[model samples]
Each structure stands twice: as structure tokens, then as C-alpha cells.
Target chain A: MKEIWTITRRELQAYFDSLMAYILLILFLGFSGFFTWIYGSDIFFVKQANLQVFFSIAYWTLFFFIPALTMRLLSEENRSGTIELLLTKPISEWQVIVAKFLAALLLIVAALALTTPYYITVSSLGNIDNGAVFSGYLALILVSGMYIAIGLFTSSITNNQIVAYLLALSIGIFFQIIFQMLSSNLTGIAGGVTDYLSINSHFESMTRGVIDSRDLIYFLSVIVLGLVFSESMLMKKRSV
Target chain B: MDIVIENMTKTYGRQKAVDNISLQVKTGEILGFLGPNGAGKTTTMKAITSFLIPDSGKIFIGNISVNDNPQEAKKNIGYLPENNPLYEDMPVIDYLQFCARIEGIAKDKINDKVREVIQTCGISREKHKKISELSKGYKQRVGLAQALIHDPEVLILDEPTTGLDPNQIIEIRELIKKIGKEKTVILSSHILAEVEATCDRIVIIKKGKIVADGTVEELRSQAQGNETLKVTIEDGGLDEIFKALQLLNTVELVDFVDKSTQTFQVKSKPGQSSRRDVFNLCVEKGWTLTQLTFIETRLEDIFYELTLDN
Candidate 1:
């Protein structure tokens, strides 16, 4: 645990030192805040005190931002040959991967935390659905976790950051929209399977204050698979 | 701790990087690894550090098998890889602290340990600077400091002095020798003089296999079996002097090195010395013996002879 924290702390410091974290936070907040407060279909337009507007905007904002945050997590290390230096220490490969994962997740959480004024202001204006607000935040966190995993897996496979970003976006698109489209155009078991694979289906349910075990299982399983694939990629580098 | 490798072999695709090689480094010994490019020196060091697993065989660091428990085995090792890769964006102090923390140093002692290594590596002046802003020599020193922070039982340095100036190389070599007094040190370099100056034992490899392993003197004598002498005599015909030197029982072959100077080169039989016989012959012929110097076989010649043709 200490080893993981040590690496995670260094990674977070690097993110901030390079101004990557600040740029990401600013862009994320700018885009989400604009669409949720002043743009079309904002909270005032809906005439509801619920934070559905913010959650929906954040969902799309994080989808684009998470890949940018994670693109350099492993790819830069691989490119710089620092992976050898890190691995030779008294730490396992899993610890390194987990540390990077936590670093990116913590940065995303910080970005989400910065927008808490939105929640407070909405509650001040009218009676908000507290349960729905809590679940909406939970849904964003879960989706961010899944996308971060996929980004890390792509980063682990290649030493080029651009390649990692593109690959991650390609993989994320299927979960974000392709599955939803395929499910609507199909029928029977195939449609049900596509719907299950669509992250939007799971994310929308959680936003509506529904936290089913199936939804949790779906998100957690994707995160685990991504982490497992990243670990395997790291191990494969040793033999090659 | 002592490092032991038993018949380790690692291949990348169809090419063998390390081909069934075995070696041992006792504590307090500095073993210099010498080889050409792609000759498996780096591959062997990587295996010892648990960075690369061998296709067949095992490595043990103080009785702990690397394949079975790499984390435990790695605790005893401090490796400075070939290129000395580091996080260029990090400050020298912060990077050392991170290395110390990862080595499982006590939280309170991390600061002190990082300071000690910084002082030891002579990077105290640049500790606060970002690694990318430092010069190459300073960067190399930082890499050394990171490796020495935990003061592991074994130190593996691959081409540690490759890019340093002459003075910096000497300083680093002295530091390595000072540290090797208690730790098992394995350093690889193609610089023959550096190896001869620092290592207690030398191992030379070619094409993924060890071609020679011994002390400098041992390799010298092993490569040169017979004694040779360049003799300069006066008041005697060069051809006659050569004939007289060759006729001696100890001398195997003799040739006129310089006819004008009356210099003759003589080669003795295996394990034989022709100096006394040649001197006696000169006295018997009433020729003045001006110079008789032994020709020592150089390390370069030995390395070339061993590494050539394979």
C-alpha cells in the first residue's frame, strides 16, 4: 500500500507540475458549467431544481476529458524507458498500474468536487431530489472510472501518447453510443445484450436514482477487465 | 548479498540474448562485465535485477529466487540501467525521495537518506534543480544517487561511465570502488582501461557467451604461453646473432628485428625463458649485449585474440 501511494503521489505531482491537471480541470469545468448553467436546456430551462442538467453535461464532458488525462499515464513512462526503472524497484506491476489509476481518478474527483457549488445553488433555488443528486454524482464517478481504465489499457499497449488517446476514444465510442444504436436497431436477445453493453443504459438508470446490482456489476466488470488487460500488457513487455 | 546465476538463457524471438550463461559475484567483489554491442551484458544484468526473466534457469539473490519472489529479491538490489532512465520533469531531491520511499525506507529517515545519497554522489548543489535542467554529468550522478539511496546489498551498473568526462569517470569509478568494499557490485563497460582500473575480476563475453573470465594477470599469461624478448647486440652480424640465438636449447625461433641496429627478436619454447641462454651465447661470441627487454602481452591484444573469429 505504501509503495502504491508513493508512486501515486509522484504521478499526481507530475500531472500538476506539467500543468496537465490544471488545463484539464479548467476545460472540464468550462464546458460542463456553460452547458449546465447558461447554454440550451440548462437548469432554468427545465424549471426543475434537480441537477439532471449538470449530470448530463458532465457525462459527455468527462467522456472526452478522461482520455486526455490518462493518455500519458503509461505511455510516457514506456517512451522514456522509465518503466524499467519503476519496475526494478521493490514493487509489483499491479501496484504501479493501480497507482496510476488512482492518480487519474483522484484528479477527476477533484474536478467533480470543484463543481459542488452547482449542487448548493440548485438546492437554494428550490427543493432538490437529494437522492437523485447523490446517485447522479455516483453515476459520473462510475463512468469516469470505466473510461480511465480503458484509457490506461490503451496507454499500456503503446509508447505514443497520441496513439493511446485515439485508441482509447475508439474503444470508448462503442460503449458510449455504438451499443446504444445497435440495441435500438436490433431485436430479442441480441438487443438485450447490446443494451446491457451500452454504458448509457446503465448510466441513465443511476442518474434517475436507481442503483441496481446489475448496473454496478456492469461498470465494475469493465473496470476490472481494463485493469487486467493493462497488467498483462506490462508483463508482456518483459518477455519482448 | 552474493548473486548467483545458474545456466540462465534468455532469447528474443529467434536471437539469443543471453545463452545459457552462469556467473557468481561474492560479496565485496567488483565484477566488470565487458562485451561488444548486443553481446548480452545488459541482458544478464537485467536478469539479475529481476527486470527480465530468463527463458530457462534461475537467479538467486542471497538465497531468494528471483523467479519465485521477485519483490523480495529486488529489495537487495540497486540497479542503474544502461541509459540511466529517470523522470526528467522531477526535481533531483523529489526523485531521490520517491526512490527511497519505494525502497521501503522509514518515513522519518527518508529525508536523511536522500540527503546522504545526494552528498555521496556529489549532487548536493543540484538537488533542487529539475532533472531535465541538469547537465549530463549531474544527471548521471542523480541516477547513481537514486540507486544508492537504500544502500542495497548488490549494485548493478550498466555502462555507468559511458558519457562522463575523464575526471568525472575517475570520480565515479572511485566511488564505485569505495562502495564495492561491502556490496556485491557488477558493472558493465566496454572501456578496457576502466575495467582494468576498477574491477577485481573481469568477464568478457561475445555473441551472448563468455569468452574469457579471470584477473588481468591471469588472462595475460593465459593468452601468452611462451616468453618473448627483443634483444639488441653490437659487434656481431645480425644473421649470425639470430642463428646463434635460435641454436640455443631454450629458444624456439629468432629473427633479425633491425639489421642495422643488430636487434634480434627471440621466442622461447612454452613455459621456458631464453634470457640466460641468450646472454650466455652473447658472452661466448664476444658480442656486447646492449638491450634485452621482455615483451609483455597487453590486455587489448588478449581481448582481441579471445573475442575475434567467433
Candidate 2:
């Protein structure tokens, strides 16, 4: 546990020390803000108190920004050969994976927190359901956690940052988009399984102002599975 | 207090990186691991450090089996890999402190241990600088400092002095010698002189197997079963001198260069010094004796002979 904390702190500090974090924040906030104020007003004709616009904009923004945030997490370590140093430490492989996961999760959480002004703005406009807004934030966290997990897993597979980014982006898009398309093609239990695997379906269900245990389980499973795969990859490499 | 490897092997696809190799290092001894490129030096070090698992056989650090309990075996080892990977953004001292924490040093003693190692590694002045900002030598020193922060019983360094200037190399060499006095050290290098200077006993590996393992003098004696005798004769015919020395039973090969200002190289039987025989030969040939020197076979010659294609 102590080793995890040590690695987490260093990773967090590294994010802030570089310009990547600031640039990601600006890009994310700028796009989210632009879509919410201008595009939201134009699309709905009369956007009084709806956060639907903000959620839509934020999700699309995260689709690209999260990959940029996580491309270097494990890839840079591999490139610099620091992975050997890290493995030689008196820490388990799971600790390293979990620490890096949490660090990336924290960066996304911080970026999401900066969007709080949109919440306050919507609340002041009209009779916006605070419950829906709160649930939407929860959904965002869960979805972002899943994305970060996938990004970390992709980062583990290669040493090139560009390759890591593209892999993460493709996997992210598949889970968020392609799985949703496949869910509709089947019926009954198989369709249910496909829907459960689709990240957008669960997140969309949660954002509709209801907290379902099934959605929580699906997202958590994805996070756990991604991390386990990363740990196993590291173990396999060390054995060879 | 000792590390024992029995028939350890690691094969990658069709190539054997570390073929069945066994060796031992006693406590508080510096064992130099010398091998040419692709001779399994790094593989052996990685296996010993528990960074890589061997395909067969066993490695025991004290009583813990490395293959069975890698984490336990790693606890007793402090490894400095060839690249010295470090977090470049963190300050030197901060990185060392992190290493100390991960090594499970007591919280109260972490700072003191970091300070001590920084001083011992001669990087006290660069402690506050970011690791990326430090020079290569200082960065290497920081790497060494982090490795020593936990004070493990055994130290494994893979090419620690590589890519350093001559002065820096000497300083790091001396530091390793000092540290080896208190811990078992397994240092790998391709340079025989560096090994001879720092290691108490040397193990030379070729083609993933132990070819020669002994002290400098022992390996030299084993490689060249002959002694080299250098004879310098003053202003005499080299052909006549060679003929006279070639007649001696102790001399196996004699090559005299230059007819005037005669200098001759003579090879004699093992454990034999033919200085007296050469002196008598020179006197008989009426050659004025100016200088006579005997050269012992060096570790370089032994290393080349063992690794070179016969």
C-alpha cells in the first residue's frame, strides 16, 4: 500500500510538471464550454435549464482528451527502461498497475471538476433537476475510469507513445461506440450481454437520473479486467 | 550471506541467452562477471536480481529460492541495471527517498539513509537538482545512491561504469570497491582491466557458459601454458642470437627483431623463467647485454584467447 502511494504521488507530480496536463485541460474545457453555450443554444432552440448539452459535449471531448492524458503513463516508462527499475523494487506488479490507474483517474477527475461552473450555470437558469446533474457527474466518473483503464492497458503493450495513443483511442471507440451498435442487432440474453459490455449504454442508463447496481458492476468489471490484463502482460514480459 | 546458482538457464525462442550456468559468490566478496557482448552477462545479472525468471534450475539468495519466491529473494538484492533508469522529473534526493520508502526502510531512518548514500555516492551537491538536469555522471551517481538506499545484503551492478569518462570511471570503480567491502557484489563488465582492478575473483563467460573462473594470475596461467621472456641485446646480430637461444631446451619459440640493436622475444615452458638462459646465450654470441625483461601473460591475453575463434 505504501509503495502504491509513493508511485501515485510521483505520477501525479509528473503530470503537473509537464505541459500535457494544462494543454489537455484547456482543450477539454474550451470544447465543452463552446458546445454548451453556443451549440446548445442553437440546437435546442430554447435551452433554459438542461444539462443534456453539457453531458453530450463533455463525453465527446473526453473521447480524445483521455487518450492524450494516458498515452505516456506506461509507455514512457517502457521507452526509458524504467520498467526494469520499477519491477526490481520490493513491490508487487499489481501495486504499480493500480497506482498508475488511480493517477490517470485522478487527472480526469480534476479535469471534470473544472466543469463545475456549467453545473452552477445550469442550476441558476431554470428548474434543472439537481439529482440528474449529480447522477450525470457520477456517470462521467465511471465512464472515464473505464477509459483510463483501457488506456493504461494499451500503454502496457508498447513503448511508442503514438502507438499507445492510437491503440487506446481505437479500443475506447470500440467500447463506447461499436459495442452499442452490436447490442441492437441481437435479442434476449445475448443482446443483454452485449449491452452490458457497451460502455455508453451503461453510462447513458446511469445519466438518466437512476443509479443501477448492474451498470456499476459493468464499469467496475471493465476497470478490473483491464488492470488484470496489464499486470499479466508485465509478468509475462518479466518471465521472458 | 551467499548467493548460489545451480544450472540456471533462460532461452528466448531458439537462442539461449543464459545457458546452463552455475556460480557462487561468498559474503563480502566482489565477484567480477566478465563476458563479451551477447555472452549472457546482462541475462545472468537479471536472473540474479529476480527481474527475470530462469527457465530451469535454481538460484538461492541465502535461503530464499529466487524461482519460487522472487519477492523474498529480491528483498536481499539491490540491482543497478546498465541504463540506470530513473524518474527524470524528480529531484535526486526525492527519488532516493522514494526508493528508500519502497524498499521498506523505517520512516524515521529514510531521510538519514538517503543522505548517507548521497554522500557516499558523491552526489551531495546535486541532491536538489532535478535528475534530468544533472550531468550523466551525476545521474549515474544518483542511480547508485538509490540502489544503496535500502542497504541490501547483496548488490548486482550490470556494467556500472559504462559510458563514463576515464575520471568518472575511476571514481565509480573506487566507490564500488568501498561498498563491496561490506556486501557481496556481482559486477559485470567487458573490460578485463576494470574487472582485475575491482574484483577479488573473476568469472569469464563466453557463449552463455563459464569458460574461465579464477583470479587474474590463475586465468592467465591457465590460458597461456608458457612464460614470455624479453631479451634486449646491445649492437649484435639478431640471427646469431636467435640461433643460440633456440638451442636451449627451455626455450620453445624465439623471434629476434633487427640485426643491429638486437631485441628478442622468447617463449619458454610454463613455470620457467629463462632470464639466465638468455643471458648466457647473449654472452656466448658475444652480444653486449643492455636490457633483459620478462613479461607475464596479462588478463587481456587470457580473455582474448578464451573468447576468440581458435
| Best candidate, TM-score | 1
Q: Could you say which candidate leads in lDDT? A: 1
Task: List the lowest-lDDT window of 10 residues for candidate 2 chain B.
Answer: B256-265
Q: Using DockQ as the measure, which candidate wins?
A: 1
Candidate 2 residue lDDT tens string, B1-310: 6999999998988999888999999998999998889999999999888888889989999999988888888888898998888899899888898889889888999989998998899887888999999888888888888788888899999889877889999999999999999899999987778999999999988889999998887887788787887777775655666787888978888886545667778898767878788888767777788877767878888888888866
Could you tell me the TM-score of candidate 2?
0.95
Whole-model alpha-carbon lDDT for candidate 2:
0.86
lDDT, each prediction: 0.93, 0.86
Alpha-carbon deviation at A167 in model 2, angstroms: 0.9
Show the colliding residue pairs in model 2.
none
Off by over 4 Å in 2: A41-50, A125-130, A185-191, B283-286
Give per-residue lDDT, candidate 2, residue A161.
90
Q: What value does the lDDT take at residue B116 in candidate 2?
A: 94
Q: What are the per-residue Cα lDDT tens digits for candidate 2 across A93-134? A: 899999999988888889889988887877776888878888
Q: Quote the positional error of residue A225 for candidate 2 in Å.
A: 1.1
**TM-score for all models, in order of appearance:** 0.97, 0.95
Candidate 1 residue-wise lDDT, A129-158, digit = tens: 889988999999999999999999999999
